[model samples]
Target chain A: MRFIHTSDWHLGRTLHNQSLLDEQAQMLETLLALIETHEVDALVIAGDIFDRSVPPAAAVSLLDAFLDKVIQQLKVSVIAIGGNHDGQERLAFGARQMARAGLYIQGPVSASISPVRVDGKHGAAFFYPIPYAEPALVRHLLEDESIQSHQDAMAALLSKVQAHNSNGLPKIVVSHCFLDGGSESDSERPLSIGGADKITPALFTPFDYAALGHLHGPQYKGAEHVRYSGSPLKYSFSEQHQNKSVTLVDMVPAKAPDIRLLPIKPQRDVRIIEGHLDTLLAQGAKDPGRDDYLMVRLLDTHAILEPMAKLRAVYPNVLHLERTGLMQERSMEGPGRERMQKSELTMFEDFFNQVQGESLSGPQKALMSDLIASLHREAGQ
Target chain B: MRFIHTSDWHLGRTLHNQSLLDEQAQMLETLLALIETHEVDALVIAGDIFDRSVPPAAAVSLLDAFLDKVIQQLKVSVIAIGGNHDGQERLAFGARQMARAGLYIQGPVSASISPVRVDGKHGAAFFYPIPYAEPALVRHLLEDESIQSHQDAMAALLSKVQAHNSNGLPKIVVSHCFLDGGSESDSERPLSIGGADKITPALFTPFDYAALGHLHGPQYKGAEHVRYSGSPLKYSFSEQHQNKSVTLVDMVPAKAPDIRLLPIKPQRDVRIIEGHLDTLLAQGAKDPGRDDYLMVRLLDTHAILEPMAKLRAVYPNVLHLERTGLMQERSMEGPGRERMQKSELTMFEDFFNQVQGESLSGPQKALMSDLIASLHREAGQ
Candidate 1:
C-alpha cells in the first residue's frame, strides 16, 4: 500500500497583520499536484489544517477546494483529524455523511475499535484516525479516567484500538499530536510546561505506521514506523533552513516500510542571510535573490533606516528584517518594569511602591493597592 | 417529507453572564423528542450553533453529546450551515467526511448547488443548503460581479440555484440569514436598518419551501413557503415573550409547506415583567414562579437599591434589571455630553470656548486635541 502523509497546514495564519491565505492556497495546490503525480493510495492530513479554532473564510474556501479536488474529484480516500488548533465540535459537525464519499474524518477524541478498512496489495489495511485530545477531555471520555496528560491520553486511545484488533490486517494510525523527542518550532502551542511526561515515545507503540502532526519538523522519534510529514510551506523565520517535504510510505507485510521524501516547492523560497547592515546593503547592491523570500538577520550595532524598503527593491520577498546582534546583547539584560508589570496595575503598583518607598503613605498605599488588585482580578477573570 | 427546521443553538450564550447552556441543552432534548415523535425525515440546522466563534470546551462537549444522540443514536439526517456568528471554515472543516453519515454542511458564500436527495414515501426531495453570504464575499464568488448589497447577493444566489434545477425534486432551501419584514431584537446583529431592503422575499422564488434562520422569531414573511424557523431558545430579554419552537416542516407535492410549531420546554423559562420597584417587589413576593427565568424591566423613577439581589431571591434567573423608563427619558432628552464630545476634557474645551469665549494657544490646543483624540480612540477601539 502506497500513501502520502502530510499535516499541520495551519491555514489562515498571518505574519503580523499580513494574510498568508494566498501562499497557503498555493502550497495546498502543490500538495495536490504531488498526490496526482505519485498515484498515492490514501492522503492523510493528520491535523491542524487551520491556524485557529475560528478560521477566516479564505481558509475555509481553500480547504473546501482542496477536499473537493483531492477527495471528490480524484477519487482518493482522504482521512483528516482535528488538531489542537481545531474546534472538535465544529470540525466533527458533518463528518458522518462525509464518510460515504471516501473522505474519512475523525474529529472526536474517542478511539474506535474497527478502523476504516482499505484493500491494498498487502491484502487489507485498517486506518485509524485519532484527533488531538486534551487530557481533561480524554479523561472524561475514557472509562478508566486515569489519563493525566497528552501521553496518557494517547496511551489510553491506543489501548482501545489495540483491544479490538482481532483480524491481523496491517494497521496504520494517523494522529495529530506532539510526539516525545520531536523538535518543535515556537509556533506549536506547549501542551504542558513541566511535563517530560508529554514527549514520551511510548504513545505510538501500538500501530505499524504512526503518521503524526503538530510538530512542524519532519522527523521520527525512537520508532522508525513513526514519522512527522512536516508542513508544506515555511511558516516562520526559524524554519528558514527546513527542507519542507511530504513522506510517501509503501507498506508490505512482515517487512520494513519504504519511505520517500518528496520535496515541496514553496510559493517563495525562504532563506535567512546573516550580515552587518553595511554588508547586507552591499549584498543587496550587488545582487539579491529576487524570487526567494529573505529574512535578513543583521549583525548591526543599531537599527537601520528604511531597511525593508531598500532590501525589498532588490528582493521582492524580503518579509522580515531583524537585528540579531542587538537581540543577543539584550537577552542577558535584567527584566524591565514594563515586562514585569504587563498591564497588571496591582503588580505595577507594588513595584512602584517598592521603588519609591518613602513617597507613599500607609492608608493611601493600602487603598491604591486594594483598588488595583480588585481591578486586576476583574479584568483577568 | 417531514423535517425539523431549527437553528442558532448558541450553546455557549449567556444572558448577561448567566449560563443558558443547561436550559438550551434541555430545550434541544425537547427538540430531539419532537423529531422522534414527528418521525422527521431530516433535521435542518441553518446556522449559529455556538454563541461565539470560539465556543468553550464545555459548549463543544455539549454539542458533541447532542450530535451523538441526534445523528449516531437517533439516526437523523442532519443538514446545517454556518451563520454570521459561526466561523464557517472551522464549522465546515471535516464536513466533507461527515456528509457520508447523512450530515450535509454548506458553508461557502458562493452559490454552491448542494442538494441532499432524501427518498420518502411520496418521492425524493432535494434539500438545497445555502448558508448566509456576506455582500463582499458574494460579490467575489458570484459570476456577475455587480451584486452590491445583501439583497442583490441573495438574488444572484437564487438565480444560480434556479439555473441548476436538474433533479426536479421537491426542493426546500435552508439558509441562515436575515429576510424582509423581520424584526430584530437587541441580541441580533443588525443586517440592515430597513425592513424590505434587508432581504427581499423574491430570493426564494424558485424553492418550494424556504427554511430560514437568524431572526429569533417564528413567522411567515407574507409568503407561505418563506419562513424563519427561529432560534430554539430565548437569547435575550427582548425575546422573553417569544414561544421558542422548532418548525416541523412537512412538505407535500402541489401544496404549501405544512409548518407546525412544536414548542420546546425551556430548562429555565425567560419572562420579562415591567412595573415600578415597589410593585415589582410586591409581584415577586406574591407570585410563586421561582423556577422560571426573569428579566425585570423596572420602570422606576429612580434607581432601585440592591435590585439584582432583591430580584434574585424570588426569580433565581433575574439575569437583567434595567430601568427602561430612565433609558427612554435619557434618550428623549437628546445626546448628553458623554455622547457628544465623549470625554470630560473635550466637553470642558467645547464649553469654555462656547460659553466664556476662552481660547487656547495654538500649541496647547494642538497638544490637547491630540491627547483627547488618542484617549477617545483608545477607549473606543
Candidate 2:
C-alpha cells in the first residue's frame, strides 16, 4: 500500500501582505500529480488544512477542489485531521457521512479515536488519526487529569488508540503536533503560541508509522518511522534553504515501510540575496529568476536613495529589504532597539512629528493612544 | 411528496451587534421538530444560508449540526442554494458527492440548471434549484447579452429549465430573488444590494410551484404556488408584525400543490414598545418578556439621563431605543437631515469640538479626516 503524507497546507497564507493563493493552488496541482505518479492508495493530511479558523471562501474553494479530485475523481481514500490552525468542529462537519465515501476526517477530540480501517492489496491497515486539541479539553474528554501538556495530551490519546490494535495489521498514526526534538522555522509560532512541550515520538511504538505535522520542515523525530512530510512551499524567508517535499510511504503488512521524499515543482522559488545595492540591482537585471520571491539584504554603507523603488523595478517580487554589514548595528541597534521598546502611539507620534514638524496635540494623542491600544488588544487575541 | 421550504436564515447575523447564533441554533432545532413530526421527504433551503460570504465558525458549526440531523439522521433530501449573501462557489463544495447523500447544493450559477429527480410514493418529482447569482454573470454564462435585469435574467434561466420539463412529473423551481410585487422590510437590503429589478413571478410559469426567498414575509407574489417561505426569525423591527413560518408543499404529479404554513415556536419574541421614560421603565420591570429583544420608543419630551442603561437594568435584552410624539420632527428633521448631508469627518469634527471645547488643529483634522475617510471607503464596500 502506498500513502502520501502531507500537512500544514496553511491555505490562505500571505507573505509580506502579498497573496500566496496562486502559489498555493499551484502546489495542490503538484500534489495531484504526485498522487497519480506515486500510485498512492490513501492520502494523509495531518492538519492545518486552513491558515485560519475561519478561512477565506477562496481558500475553502481551493481545498474543496483539491479534495474533490482526490476523493471523487481519483477515487482515493483520504484520512485528514484537525490541526492547531483548523477549526476542529468545523473541519469535521461531514466526518460521519463522508467516511462511507472513503473520506475520513477526525473532528473534535474524543476519548477514543476509532481506527479507520482501509484494506489494500496486501492487507487491511488501521489508521488512528489524533486531531489537535487543547490539553484541558483532552483531559476533560479522557477523564484523566494527567494530561497536563501537549506531550501528555498526545500520550493519553495514543493510549486510548492502542486499545483497538488487536487486528495485527500495519497500523499508522496520523497527527499534528511539535515533537520534543522537532526543529522550528520562522513561520511557526513559538512555544507560547504553539505550546511546544516534550511530545516524544516514543508514544507511537504501538504503530508501524507515524505521519506528523506542525513543523514546516520535514524530518523524523527520534525515529525514522515517525516523520513529518513538511509544508509543500516555503512559508517564511528562513525556509528558503530548506528542500520542501511530500512524504511517500510504501508499505506491506508486518514490514518496515519504504519512505521516500518526493519533490514538488513550485512555480516560483523563494530566494534571499546579500550584496551591495548597486551590485544586486545589476545582478537582478541579468538574473533568470528575477520574478522569484526575494528578500534582498543590502551591504551598502552609506544611505542609498530610493533603494526599494530601484530594486522593485529590477526584481518585481522583492518582498523584503534590509541593510546589513556596515548598516547592521546602526539599523538594528541604538535607535531601532529604543524604537522597538516604544508603544505604537509613540512611534506614530514620532512619525507625525517628523512629517508635520509639530508634536501631536493632547486630543490627538488621546485618539492615537486609544486606537493603538485597541489594535494591540485585538492583535493579542 | 412533502417538501419543507425555508430560506434567508441569515445565520451569523447580529441584531444591533447582539449575537443571534443562539437563537439561530434554537430555530434549527425547532426545524428539526417540524421535519420529524411532519415527516418531510425533502428540504428546500432556497438561499441566504449565511448572512455573509465568510461566516463565523460558530455559524458553520450550527448549520452543520442542523443539516447533519436532517440529511444523515432523519435521512431527508435537502436541496439548498447559494444566495446573494452566500459565497456561491464556497457553498457548492462537494455538490456532486453530497448529492448521493441527498444534499444537493447549487454552487455558482450555471448556463442551464439540471433538475434533481427524487422519487416519492406519488412517483418521481423534479426539483430545479436556480441559486442566487448576478445578472451579468448569468448573461455571460448563458452567452445571452439580452439578460440585463433580474427579470430578464430569470426569464433567460427559466427558458432553459423549461426544456427539461417534458417528463411531465411535478416540477418546482427554488430560487432567491426580489420579485417585482413583493412587500419588503427594513432588515432586507435595498435594491442596490439585493438587485430588485422587476423579477416578476410570471417567470416561474413552467413549474408547478416556486419556492422563493429574499423577502422576509411568507407570501405568494403572483400565484399561490409561487410563495416565499420567509425568514424563520424576525430580523428587524419592521418584521415584528409579520408571522414567521416554514412552507410545507404537498405535491402530486398533475395535481395542485397544497401549501401549508408550518409554525416554529421561537424562544423569545421581538418587541417594540413606546411610553414615557419612567413609565416604560416601570412597565419593563413588570413585563413578562423583559428578557426578549426590545426596541423602546420614549414619548417623553425631555432628555432622559442614561436611558439605555436604566432600561437595560430592568430589561436585560433591550436592543434599541428611540423617541416619538414630541421628539419626532426634532429627532428626524433639521439637524438629522443636516447630519446626514455632512461628511462623517465633519460630524466627527463637530462632536470633537463640542466634547473637547476646542476645534481640531490642522494636522489633527487631517488625521481625523484620513481615518474617517478610510472607514467610509471600507463601509461603503
Candidate 3:
C-alpha cells in the first residue's frame, strides 16, 4: 500500500493581513493532482488544517473544495488529525461518520487507540491516527496525576498503544507532534523545549512508520520510519527556497520502504528578491511567474512610496515587502513618545533608584520635584 | 426515505450565562435513538449547530461526539448546512470529504443545487442543503451588483436548484432560515424585520420537503413543505412549556407524509414556580424533580436573604430567579430646597418651564447659580 503524507495546511494564514487564499488554493490543487498522478491510496494530513481556530470563511471554502476533490472526486482515503492551531472539536466533528467512507479524522488526544487498517498484498497495515497531545492532557488521561513533561506524555501514549496491539501488523502512526532531531523552521510552532511534552526519539520505538505533521519541514528522527511530510506550500520566505512536496511511501515486503518526494507546483511562486525598489519591480514585471506570491526585500537607500501598490501592478500577489537598509534611518526617528508620559519614566526611575539604594544630586532632586509637581497638577485637572 | 429533521442545536448556547450544553446533549442523544428506532435513513441538521461563530472548545467536542454516534454507530446519513448564527465557511470546512461518508454539508448558497441522493427501496430522494445566505453575498455571487434582500437571494437559490434538477428526483431542501408566517420565539436571532434579509415563505415553492432551522419552534409557513423543525432542547424559559422534539417524517408514495413528533427527555427539566420566598423554598425542596433546572419567581414582600443559596440547595440547576414584587417607600426627610438642587426632578421642571416660556422663581435662580458655581469650582480644582 502506498500513501501521500502531508500536514499543517494552515489554510487561512495571512502574512500581516495579506490574503493567502489564492496561493493556498493553487498549492492544495497541485497536491491533489500529485495524488491522482501518484495513485496514492491514502492522504495523511497530520494537523493544523487551518491557520486559526476560527478560520476565515474563504479559507474554509477553499479547504472544503480541496477535501471534496481529494476524497469524492479522486476516491482516496484521507487520514487527518487536529493540530494545536486547530480547534479540536471542530475538526473532530463528523469524524466518526466520515471514517466509514475512508476519510478518517482523529481530533482530540485520547487514551483509546484508533487504528485504520488498510489491506495490502502481504496482509494489512494498521495506521494509528494520533492528534497533537499536550502533556497535561496526557497526565489527565493516564490518571497518574504526577506526569508533567512531554517525555512522560509520550511514554504514556506509546505504552497505551503497545498494550492495545492485539495483532502485530505493520503499523503506521500519523501524528501532529514536535520530535527530537528534526530541523526547526520559522513557520513550525514550538510546543515545548524542556517540559513534560518534549518527547525524544526513544518514545516512538513501537511504530513501523511514523507519518508526523506540525513541523513544516520534511525530515525524519531516530529511524527511517519516522518522517514529517512537511507543508504542501512554502509558508515563509525562509521556506521560499525549500522544495515543498508530499511524501509518497510504498510499503511492501523484501524492500526497505520506497519513499519519494512529490513536488507541489505553486499557483504562484514565492520569490524573495533583494534589490532597490525600482529594480525589484522591474524584475517582477518582466518575470513570467509574477502572477505568483512574492516577498521583496528593499535594499533601497531611502523608503519607497507605495511599494506594494507599485509591485502589485505586475505581481498582484505581492504579499510581503520589507525594507532592509532603510531600517537604520527609520530607527533614528524612533517610536512615537506620546504613548509614554514623563511621569511614567519618573516612576520607573524612582523605583530603580530605591532598588539600587541611590541618592539623588541637588539638580536631579529639583528636576524630579518639578516632574512630580506637574504630574500632581495634571491629576487634579 | 424516512428521516428525523432537527436544527438549531446551539450545543454550547448560553441564556444570560446559563449553560444549556448538558440539556442539549441529552436531547440530541434522544433524537438519535429515535432515528434508530424509527429506522430513519438520513438525519437532517438544518443549521446553527453552534450559537457563536467561534464556538468554545466544549461545544465543538459535543457536536463531534454526536456526529460520531450518528454517522458511525447508527449508519445514518446527515445533511447539515450553516445558519445565520454559524460562520458558513468554518462549518463547511472538510464537508466535501465528509460527504463521501454520506455526511452532506452545504454552506455556500451558490452551491445549493449540489444534492446528496439517498436511494431507498421506495425511490431516490435528493437532499439539497441551502445554508443561510446573506444578501451582500448573494449580490457578489450572482454578479447582479444591485440585488438585495434574502427573499431575492433565496429566489436566486431556488432557480439554481430548479435548473440543476435534470434527474427530477424527489427533492428535500434543508435550509437554515426564517420565513413569513413563521412564529418566532425570543431565542431566534432576527436577521431583519422587513429589511434586506427578511425572507418570505413564497420563495420555497419547489421542494417536496423543507426541513428548516432557526425560529426555535415547529411552524408551517403557508406551504406544508416549508416547516421549521425547531430546537431539540428548551433554550430559554420562554420555551420551557414547549414540547421539544425531533420531527420524524415517513416519505411514502401515494400517501401524504406522516409526521410524528418524537419527544426528547430533557437533561434537566425546567419548572417555573411562583410563591413567597419561604413557601417557594419549602415547595421547591419537596418537589420530586428538584434535580431539574428551575426558574423560581419569589413573590416576597421584601428582598429575601440569600434566596439563590436557599433554592440552590434543592435545585442545583436553579438558573433563573426573580423578585416578583417589591416596592420602596419614598424618603421625605431632606430639606426641600437642598433636595431639589440635587434632583433630576428639578432639572425636568426647568426644562418644562423653559418649554412653557415660564420665568424661574428668584429662589430657583439663586439655587441654579449656586449649583453652577459649585460645578465650576470642582472642575477648576
Candidate 4:
C-alpha cells in the first residue's frame, strides 16, 4: 500500500506570539497538492494532530476541514493517532463512527490493538496504530505491572498487537513516542517528569514499517524501517536547520518497503541569519525570502542602539534578535566563569576574540602579555 | 417514528463544585434502558451536550462510550445539535464521517439545514437540525443583514429548512434556542449577554414537531408540538423543585406529534431542607435519600459553629449551608432601608415572625406596638 506518513502538525501553535493558523492553513494546501500529485492511497498522521489537549476552536475547524477534504474529497483513507499533546478521548470523539468512512482515528492505549487494513495494487497491508501512551496508563490498561518504562510499555503493546495480527501480511505500526537515538527539538514537550521515556526501535522488528512522531527531526532510529516523519513546520528555533518532509511508504509482501521522503515547503521557513546590523538590513531588502520567520544575530563589536527596531524596517518577520558580543560577555559571567578552567591570559584572549569576532594579532597579544606581567610585578611590590 | 428526545445533558457539569460524572454515567444507563424498552427509532439530543466548550477528558471518554453503546451496540441512530455553550466546530468534530454511521451531529448555523430522516412503521419523517445560531452568525451565513434578532434568525433558518423539505412528510425541527413563553431555570445559560434571545414559537408553524432545548424546564412553548425535554438532572438549587425528564415524540404522517415526558430519576437529587442543625441531623438518619445533594437552612436563632462540618457527619453531600436569621437581618439593613415601604413597627413585627417562625399572637402584637410607641416618643424627646 502507498501511504503518506506525517505527524505533529501542532495546529494552533504560535511562533513568537504570532499565530501559525494562517501558515498552517496554507501548508495544508501544499499537503493537498502533494497528495494529489503522488496519488497517495492513504494518509497516516501518527500523532500530535493538535498542539494542545483542548485546542482553539479555529484549530478544531481547520482539522475538520482537512479531514473532510482528504477522506471525502480525495476518497482516501486516513489513520490518525493521538499524541501526548492531545487529550486522547477528545481526539477520539466519533472515531469509531469515522472509521466506517475510511478515517481510522486511534486514541489512547488499549490492550486489544486493532489493525486498519489498507489494500493497494500489490496486496493488503495491516496497519496497527499504537497511540502515545504513558507507562502508568499502559500498565493499568494492559494489567502489566512490570511495564515500568516506555520501553516496557511499547514492548507489551506491540506483543498484544502481534497476538491479534498473526496473519502473514505486511504489518505497519504507526505510533508516537520518543525513540532512542532520535533527535529532539525544544517544541516536543517531554512525556514524563522523570527520565526513561525513550523506547528502543528494536521493539518494531516484527513490523515492516514504523511511522513515528514526537521528535521534530525526521530520521531513522536504529533501523531504516523505523523512522520519524518529523513535524510539518519548524515549531522551535532549535529545529531551524532541519528540512521537514513527509515520508511516503510503499509496502509489499515480499521485499523491504520502498521509502521516500517528499520534502515539504513550509508556508514561511524558519531561518537564522548573522551579519553586521547595517549589512543584514541591506541583505533583507534584497532578499526574496525576507518574509520568512527569522532569528538575526549581529556580529558587530560595538553596541547598536535599537538594533531590533532598525532590523524590523526591512526584515518584517524577525522573531528574535541578539548582539553576540553582549550575549557572550553575559554568558561568560555565568557558569562560564568556573567552566573556563584557563589562565587569566588565556581567558582574556578568548574574551577579546569573542568581542572582536577575531583573534588578536601576535604583536598585540605580546604587548598585552607584557602589560599583564608589569601589573603583576606592581601588585607584588 | 418514535424518538427519545433529550437535551441539556451538560455532561461534566459539577453541582456545587462536586463532580457529577458518575451521576451522568448512571443517567446514560437509564437513557439506554428507555431506548431499548421503547424501541426508539432514533435518539435525538437537541443541544448543550457538554457543560463547557472544553470538557474534561474523562467526560469526553464518557460521551464516546455512550455514543458507542447507542450507535454501535444497540444499532440506534442518533441526531444531536450544538448549543450556545458548545464550541460548535469542536463539538461537531468528525460529524461528517459520523453521519454515515447514523450519528448525525449538527453543529453551527448553516444556510442549508439538511434533514436527517428517521423511518418508523408509519413512514419516513424528515428532521431539520437547526443548531443554535447567534443573530450575527445567522445574518452572515444566510447573507441576510436584516436578521437582527433571535426571532429573525430563527425565522430565516426555519424558512431555509422549509424550502428544503417541501415533501408532504411529517417534519420535525430539532434545535437549541430560547423560545418565547418557555419556562426557564437558573441552570439554563442565557444565550446572549444582552436580552432578545427568545425566538417566537410561531416560527415553527411549518414543522410538524419541534424538539427544543435551552430551557431546563420540560414544557411546551405556545404550542403542544413544540417542547423542551429539560435536563436529565437538576443542575441548580432553583431547579430543585422541578421534575427532570426526557421527552418522547411519536410522529406519523398527517397528525400532531404525540409527546410524552419520561421522568428521569437522578443519581442524587438536589434538595433544600430547612430545620435546626440538630433536628436535621436526627431526621437524616431516617431519610433514605440522605445522600442527595442538599442546601441546608438553619432555622435556629442561636449561633452554630461549623454547621457545615456538623452537617457533613450525617448529610455527607450538604452543598450549601445558611442561617436564615443572620441572613434575613443582613438583607434588611441594606437597600431594605429605602425599599422597605413598611412602617418600622410593622417591620419589627415581620422580623419577629420570621425569626421565631411563627405569627405574633394578639397579646404579643399589642406589647410590640406599645414598646415601639415608647421608643418613638423617647427618640422624639
Highest lDDT model number: 4
1 or 2, which is superior by lDDT?
2
Q: Measured by TM-score, how close is model 1 to the native structure? A: 0.76
Worst 10 residues of 3 chain A by lDDT: A337-346
- Tell me the docking grade of candidate 4: medium
Which lDDT tens digits does candidate 2 get at residues B189-242? 654555455587788855898999899999897788999999999899898888
- Model 2, A28-110: lDDT tens digits are 99999889876788999998888877778798888888888998888888999988888876677656656777788897778
- What's the C-alpha lDDT at position B121 in model 3? 43
lDDT of 4 by residue, A59-102 (tens): 99999998899989988899899999888889999899899999
Write down the TM-score for model 3.
0.76
Model 3 lDDT per residue over A226-264, tens place: 888888877777787778888988876545577888887
* Per-residue accuracy of model 4 over B1-381 as CA lDDT, tens digit each: 888899999999998899999999999999999998888888999999999889888988999999989999878889999987777889999899999999999988777888888765545778889898889988998888898999998888887777874467777899999987778798888888666998888888667888998988888877888888899888999998899889888885567887888989988999899987778999999999899999999886545556798898999999998788656654656464333323455566657765787777899888877776676677663
Candidate 3, after superposition: displacement of residue B108 in Å? 2.4
**Isolated chain A: TM-score per model?**
0.81, 0.84, 0.80, 0.85
Q: List runs of model 3 lying over 4 Å from the truth.
A: A119-124, A143-148, A159-169, A193-197, A202-208, A265-381, B115-128, B135-148, B152-173, B195-209, B221-226, B289-298, B301-315, B318-324, B327-381
lDDT of 1: 0.75
The sequence of per-residue lDDT tens digits that candidate 1 reaches over residues A161-257 is: 7776638877788888777678877577776677533546666765789888888878988788888998877777778778999899888777877
Q: Considering summed lDDT, which 10 consecutive residues are worst modelled in model 2 chain B?
A: B336-345
Top-scoring candidate (DockQ):
4
